[model samples]
Target: MKGWRAQPGRLAAIALLVALALFAIIKTDDVMRANALVAEEEAAMDGAAILASSLSSELDKFSLLPLALAEDPQVKALVAGDRDAARALDRRLETLASQSDAAAIYVMDAQGLTLAASNHALPTSFVNSNYAFRSYFREAMDKGSSTQFALGTVSRKPGLYIAARVGPSNAPSGVVAVKVEFDRTEENWRRATRGVYVTDREGVVLLTSEEAWRFHLTGSAPAAPRDPAEDLRQFGIAELPRLELPLAGASGEIVQVPLVEAQQAIGPAGWDIHLIVDPGPRVAAALATGRLVLVSIAVVVFAVIFALFAANRRRRAHEEAVVAQRTRTLREQLSQANRLATLGQISAGVNHEIGQPVSAIRVFAESGSKLVAAGETGQAAQNFSEIVSLADRIGAITSELRRFGRRQPGEKRIVAIGEIIDGALLLLRDRIHSHGRDIDLPEEDLRRVTVEAEHVRLEQVLVNLLQNALDATDFGGRIAIEIALLPDAVHLHVVDEGHGIPAASRDTLFHPFATSKDDGLGLGLVIAREIMRDLSGDLVFDANRQHTTFTMIIPRHR
Candidate 1:
């Protein structure tokens, strides 16, 4: 179990991978945060630029109103104090104001006394009021033209007042003023759900969607520097501190509660319009982006980890498979070497077995030669026949041994078990006779017991088993080969009348080179078993029995 566990190096590699993943997670979070910050800043800058452009375009449309009004003949006549033309001029002013979306249009003498106005029908009309105190009127008298954002004296509406002189500079007569209210502009901003407002040079919020923010100074100022009005009658400077103006100044948010701001100058009024948008959603979006990046990084990290792990596993398995194949090849090589060694050991026994037959053939031939000389022709023929039979036996034995000792895989076919036994007896007959042992086997049993096996290999198996039995038996001892017919296989048992295999040699009796006799290699049983198994059979030895028996069983032929 301990050996089956993962090696420390492999465990350490996994741990290192986990550490790397943790490190990646840390770096990924940092990278995500940085990227999110960059996106947030860029979005803020873009939002500001878009808002500034929209605000500037809204104010630029009414910039030429004062120049158009000043050149009108009706306005010029009214400015010259033509009392009879007052009724027509008033009608013209009211019509012009209504048509042009102006809050009010008025004519003021050089002394700032209002002559006529679009709102003259109202109780708070500009007809009698002296607007000499108003900056737009005074600035036009001196500079001929000016843009001013102020509270209207007649309508009390906050508007941008663009005014121009009516007469020549040498004899200036009056100022014609067009007051454009930004109520629609403010409404547009409100509808768009944005915070927008315009501030004059003095930093006072003249126009805003929030009515309560009017007249409030958006920034610190030392008393409304370069005040537009000579007399601040309509606008109470004392109440400026109490007005609540929503502002984030030039930078930062410009909403009612701003985080960033975009400021642009309104061309006609010379005022700074501040545009603010909520930053809550942008901050939320940045956070969302950071989370998404982290999640994506985590997924990639885990995927890489999984792939690495799988690849490592496959590599290890391939290495193990290669190692196993190498071991199997080594085992086969060793087995083949052992077989060749066994063949060398048995060759001497084969020479002795063949010598006996040759000696017998010579003896029978000499007998036949003597009988032929004595003129017993029939008897001589029988003697010669016996010599030929012995010679054939010798040739058969030598041929089978020569073919079996060669390094070749023998072909398998259906063969009778008796044929294998007869071949083995042929080779071992001299040894059997030399040992003075009788091998018992009935001719009827030999042909009926059949097996499927290679002819030479089967003969080799029987020879090895019978040789062992012949060697173990005492002089004049009996050796028996008994065939046991089974349902699936044919079993041949070679039993020897000898002292049983020693207890100490029993375990490794069939082991190669482990032998009881000094000259024995102990590979006989090993080779026999190997041969039997190659024929889809097995070798079993029963040393515990009264008589030692070595059985070679091969599968029955169909």
Candidate 2:
């Protein structure tokens, strides 16, 4: 009789626990589903806002075209009744339309007769076509400028027409208009979302990623009945059918459908863009995650209670061993990463150092072959000697790069400034001669100045600066090397008269992998700067000048 009474108490406790567990699960599901829907809706809103911004940007980009074209001399002349200007204006508009990615560009008289168009050569050209009844034409003439989105009368394609009046505002001569299409924008939206559409103030869809939704009403019906003629002119249809999209409801409530919708205004044009997304996948994932977390907590609590009575010493020792092994593996990975990074730096240095000599050797070999064919034996022999010298220089560069990679100090010696400049110029002789660029060396007395540096490294730095100057200077331009003697250092400036370095590039001028040249490896300046620092000197850019200047400051050898 006592055991039966205890069973009833145990059963009551079990029922209480079961009720709490069920309540927790239900609450978790509700919270997860609500959060998932909110996230999906927010994401949809972001997408809609981006698409709206893009549409606004596209419209704004082409809006100024008509206004600028209205000021063109040819357009003005054509508007002044000069028939000869029509052919020229046609070609001009064609070129402008192609360059600006516009669907069409045309000029119309005050009476709305198309005088000239970009597609004049096409069979379906707008020339001689009348668009007097178009709202854009009438509004532009009266208000000085106007924009309207409508279906093309001839092509039947939809586009936004931007029009601007030509001549005085009081009495305009004609109007210039540019049409911009949104096929690309709609294609992009289709690739990004399930559904997207843009609606006018009247709730009629003007642009949509879904083809079936275009020219349809977003609401159950139009706010008011539209004139059949006006509807036909704007949308090529007398009436529009409502899309099956549902209106957004209050948030956090579970709905029958799994779709979330968001809308954003495109611009002041009273256009609204709607983006739809399916939240079923996110909601399912959240539910699965919540259940897994709840089940894991239950399992972990049971495990912890059981682990308190188990053998802990062995387990703790095993965990320590595992941790030690993991530490060793991570150390090995870090060491390997360090080795790879060092190897990459060395490779870049070798490539930059060897590039100039290899190019010189090729130029010399080509000249030598030509000289041999022309029976110029002495000149050919000289070219062969130069190629051999360049080959030896390449070998030296590889050894220097290895030392640089190892962080070993290069051998320093007293090198005259003149010799360094001469060496660099000799290496770039072919480039200078080919491009017809002038190099103005310092005075002969100043050339005798000496600096404490590694000869080859110093020569390499000069070569890099001179090469950059050569690339920047135009044909027949001048590059000057000026020497400024300081109390303890010598400042050698490589100045070029070509287009100066862009302001945007000055900050990252010496950063690795930052270059203005299309073919540049972006390592030359980095290596050059490092070499200067290694030699106990520094390289710096001088921006307070009319031309681009790079100054190399070195310790003067007494």
Best model number under TM-score: 2
Using lDDT as the measure, the top candidate is 2
Model 2 CA lDDT for position 476: 95
Q: What TM-score against the true fold does each predicted structure earn?
A: 0.45, 0.52
- Per-residue lDDT of candidate 2, residues 132-217 (tens digit): 78899989999889888899987788988899999888889999998888899889877877778888888888888777778988
Error of 1 at 471 (Å): 99
Clashes of 1: 6
What lDDT score goes with residue 320 in model 2? 97
**Model 2, residue pairs in steric clash:** none
Model 2 stretches with alpha carbons more than 4 Å out: 1-14, 220-222, 247-258, 304-558
User: For each candidate, how many residue pairs have backbone atoms clashing (under 3 Å)?
Assistant: 6, 0
lDDT of 1 by residue, 286-366 (tens): 556666776787788689779988899999999999999997576545545555654665667678877777888888889
lDDT of 2 at 179: 85
